[model samples]
Target: MTDNLPLAGRGCVVTGGSRGIGAAIVRLALAQGADVVFGYHSDEKRASTLVDELRAAHPDRQCSALQADVADGGEAERFATEALDRLGRLDVLVNNAGITRDALFARMRPEQWHEVIGTNLDSMYTVTRPLLMPLVKQRGGAVINITSSTGLHGVPGQTAYAAAKAGVIGFTKSLAKEIGARGVTVNAVAPGLIETDMTAAIPEDKAEFLKSLIPSHAFGSPDDVAHLVCYLASEKARYITGQVIEISGGLVL
Candidate 1:
């Protein structure tokens, strides 16, 4: 309601916002008073449900979702264009869409490698390239890429995932330098062992093993990552860019 709120009146677009960390970012963005358009790859039911809930809570805010697979360049472009159409302009772009294909390097199939790379790394170019000019023209905004702890420290069976996430980090740093002069802050958030469906799939024994690796001896929640993203998207973080801030509960330290 008040302009003093960090992201009041701003517009945001979040990819893969139908569930998990993506969903948390969407909710936090709306709570910060930003009009948001989010994309979902397949789960139309979940996407529709989230949109409905947000709309009900903020009747006057623009909260919408589109079914899109941002791994495809054409779909990414269309999703960005539609987001601009719905919100009029963009102030924050959260590249939170990614996938994991965990397998030992020796056992990994080409499709597994391709899927992870296309979704996690290539989607960065596809989703952000179309919107880059407009964001630069706007002269102030934030671009937050969701990376991972595996990217920071290599994981044994996650060769493809780690590589893709590492690429995201590299892309974020390079883009930040290019866009910083234009007032668009680009950064990456790498989460560790977050309690999402992705982590839920880990066998209980493996999950406990990971928990032991974290200094906090626990898995982080989606909100934990969302809170950091909210700060990075705000004016408070204007001076912060080209950095990878990890929310790993001391896992990487």
Candidate 2:
């Protein structure tokens, strides 16, 4: 490993890492000298392909993928156990597994609310609970949760998603204080209208309207978010904790 690399020798775990922002984090983490074990929900083919590509690219570092349903406590625990075993240690945990079940509040179904809450908010506990003790015991690590701007400013059709992500912000602050003395840093990264599968699903007219809200009038890419996440995971951000750093191009400003 290059000694000058920012995350050299760190063992990291990322959830929902097969695609989008999570995949970008995994790729950049490996490039920056971290051994990463990431979790994927359902696309085994995509996950395997990512693993193969990364392994080929970073022949010196460890890059592995495991099937995980972060919304389920049992599955999350199992994934955590296997991740720790594979890496033989843990230093960074990125909670990036989430889903969007957007609907107008009046028309939102019960299952939609539950599904959004379960996958986004509940997974925060299910995934972090098992992996947290290791970081605490080690006395140094980072926990970066991927939240959304909707969680901060709220959105009309994303009441459930916003609620869950807002809960994530609350969870992040509380946990940062709880573990700050233990040398663990916890923070949330809120992205605004990033170009991802989620944003692609937005109607073109709506997307244009949202784009106009940003000062840059352009959507951020997954790599933009990944850069911030990797920085937080590195030693440079060790002194930073319990903050929500928004990566939007001045959206809602």
Candidate 3:
């Protein structure tokens, strides 16, 4: 956050930054003195407001918003180009855009499966590929993928979502090995039952029941995950890579 902090002057790109976890990441990174560009799917109003707010908060730092659906390969590529162009440099990339089409494996439609994979899994490649050269050329950068605990524990009735997120875990590990030598680091953050609009879709009773399983008897917040993200993007974590760190208040443990 300061001149001595790892994130100072680093350029950051956060997907799905209009609200929830991605928004939190944008705010935290900006507060830490990182120039930030956040991507949104549809909510241009909120995205605009966030950019305005951040500009006010960090008057001297670079802050802006971009619109792109990481689900679409072509759009993802364009988004990366625009982000790099607008930010001038990119030192950290957060793959936080995702969607869920919940249904039992037998009931899940083909469209549902494709949508989940495209938005959650395929976007990792679609988005990251465009930035790879720039990151490698710059000599170093960090890539952080956001996956759910469902990816690890295999949640029932969310076959499509689970599979795609699980793929992110493997993708992160493999990509890390390929790019670490370039001074780039890739890792995945798997959150357990985080309190977000995504979780709000679940029935309240079911959400309460899940909370009981958390040792803290509470759901994790966007800021909780943001903390770990900031840490991983810091020099303190330079030695950490190719790992899937869970922040579930001991929910997964």
Candidate 4:
């Protein structure tokens, strides 16, 4: 965070930012001059390495990584508390952390359902409840929740995952209404089908077919969503809120 950069003094938190899209967001934010804190469940070696790398680039911008299972209510609360503490005040909260336990409804175990819901849906409450106020106190702030296209339109064998993501969409819209007057904006990004470790396990032929369905004929990058996030967090997006923006290469249309 050199003297001339914008977003230099802003404080931000990115959950599950150790790898994939979350990590990409971390890098983008750091480069844009925002001091950041990222939350992780484990793999301190990887997490610490990322923090070190970002801090190296911006000595004045602080970066912290905390180990917390976003699925656990207590851990989520603690993560939010310590994140705000590290940054002093939070201007942005990106709920980019999620896990998928894909299974057909007929054979989906009860545990699969719970894990997906707890990690994906219930987590919204756990993480945001603790930090919502600090952002409002800042006079204005942004809350970005990461969702999926499968959630918007059901997919086979992903009942649990789809349900959880759909829950995020609904929750964010309602919260937007509740907080509109408080200077806090709530929005959700429903990514259609981007390449990530979660989807790396997907069969190649299937991936190709999915890509063909998309008009762009290509997968989106993490930087794609990160750009939207950066804009929404900035003064440029002051008038946009309660919207569920999709980044699916025209897959829905």
Candidate 5:
């Protein structure tokens, strides 16, 4: 591995890495010379394909997958343990797992709110809680949480999603302060309307309208978010923490 690959000799764990932005993070982390272990909820085939593809490219490094609903504390514990065992040590943790159940508050069911919160916000605690000691014991690491623009500026129909993502920001900042002395860094990346399976749900007209709001007049790709995450996880970003950096092509600006 070369010096340019900033994450050389590191071990990374990403949740919900079967597809979309999560998948991109996994690919980039591996490319940067990190042994990676990722969790996926259901998509076994997609997860297997990604593992195979990444393993083929970096045969010397470890690439592993664990099937677990990270929103559940028990499952998250199991996932973290297995990943640590496989990678030997943890250097970075990316909380990229999330789900959106969009609706107007008046019509939003309790299940929708709970589900979104559980998967997006609560999963942060579930997954990260189990891994905190490992990171702190290591004496240094990076924690990157994948938030959304809707969290920074609320959207009309994304009450649950907005709330969950916003919670992620709070979690990131608070955790950063709590762990800073241990040489660990915690930060958030708020991506705006990235071109992913998640955004594929937006109606064509609505998607176009959203793009018009961005100065770039275009949607971002998963790689856009991945690049930022890789930087945050590297030694170069050691001085940066408890900050929310948006990768939205000036959408919020």
Candidate 6:
């Protein structure tokens, strides 16, 4: 059974793993046989509940959650340190934490812009910097960053989000090149209109409009994105790096 597992014996760290796609990734990674230490921003209850559920379901695996603001370097560093301590060694790092401040560029406040940028873009640096050396030293690992289609195609009311996610793409490519020779695979996963808490807040009319843009005529489930992410983290995708894989159910917008 262990040999059949894609991530058997692997150690993983995920950011923003309390709910939504990040949570999905944490769940699936553990189900696939990895020991995981995930970070949550706030909502200790939600995070603890998730950790409890995962532990119950996978009694043989290690699962824990810690609180950290990925936007702050100090907090992120502490989270990374604690996560590494819990996992012992890291084989995969998932940068799944992000926030969206949707507003037109002209009307966007400074705080909104900065918040989105700090969480979505700066987190790539804050979280990865502390854990990257372990991967390089091992000369084998995977880094999967969660970006969004808004970054690739651009959205009308998401200027700050688009900028931050786009910056994530640039960061993924450069880092992949820098560490590829060391056998670390770095890639970005771009999700489009996944069914999560964030999308649940969309207006009925707006939701329908967004759905019409997708060739599937439906929003993808969090599991859809999780499957892609897990595949990237597995040895199956060892040769694939420095790429942005979009799982948007063929959403044009």
Off by over 4 Å in 3: none
lDDT of 1 by residue, 176-221 (tens): 9998999999999999989988898899998888888888899999
Please state the error at residue 142 of candidate 4 in Å. Answer: 0.7
Clashes of 4: 0
Residue pairs in candidate 4 whose N, alpha carbon or C atoms collide under 3 angstroms: none
Backbone collision count in every prediction? 0, 0, 0, 0, 0, 0
Instruction: Kindly list the per-residue Cα lDDT of model 4 for residues 60-167, writing each as its tens digit.
Output: 778889999999989999899998888988888999899888888999999999999988899899999999888777778889999888889989999999999999
For candidate 5, what is the TM-score? 0.98
> After best superposition, candidate 1 residue 49: deviation in angstroms?
0.3
Better of 4 and 6 by TM-score: 6
**Residue-level lDDT for 58 in candidate 1:** 82
RMSD (Cα, Å) for all candidates, in order, is 1.0, 0.8, 1.3, 1.5, 1.1, 0.6
Q: What residue pairs are clashing in model 2?
A: none
> What tens-digit string does per-residue lDDT give for candidate 3 at 64-147?
888988988889999999999998998999999998889989888999999899999999999999998998898788999999
- TM-score order of candidates, best first? 6, 2, 1, 5, 3, 4
What candidate 1 gets wrong by more than 4 Å, as runs, is none
- Cα-based lDDT for every prediction: 0.93, 0.95, 0.90, 0.87, 0.93, 0.96
Candidate 4: give its CA RMSD in angstroms. Answer: 1.5
The Cα error of candidate 5 at residue 217, in Å, is 1.2
Pairs clashing within candidate 6: none
Q: TM-score of model 1 relative to the true fold? A: 0.98
TM-score of each predicted structure versus truth: 0.98, 0.99, 0.97, 0.96, 0.98, 0.99
- lDDT (Cα, tens digit) per residue for candidate 5, span 61-156: 899899999878899999988898988999999999998888899999999999999999999999999889999999999999999999999999
* lDDT for model 2: 0.95
Cα lDDT of model 2 by residue, 30-83, tens digit: 999999999999899999999999999989999999998998899999999999
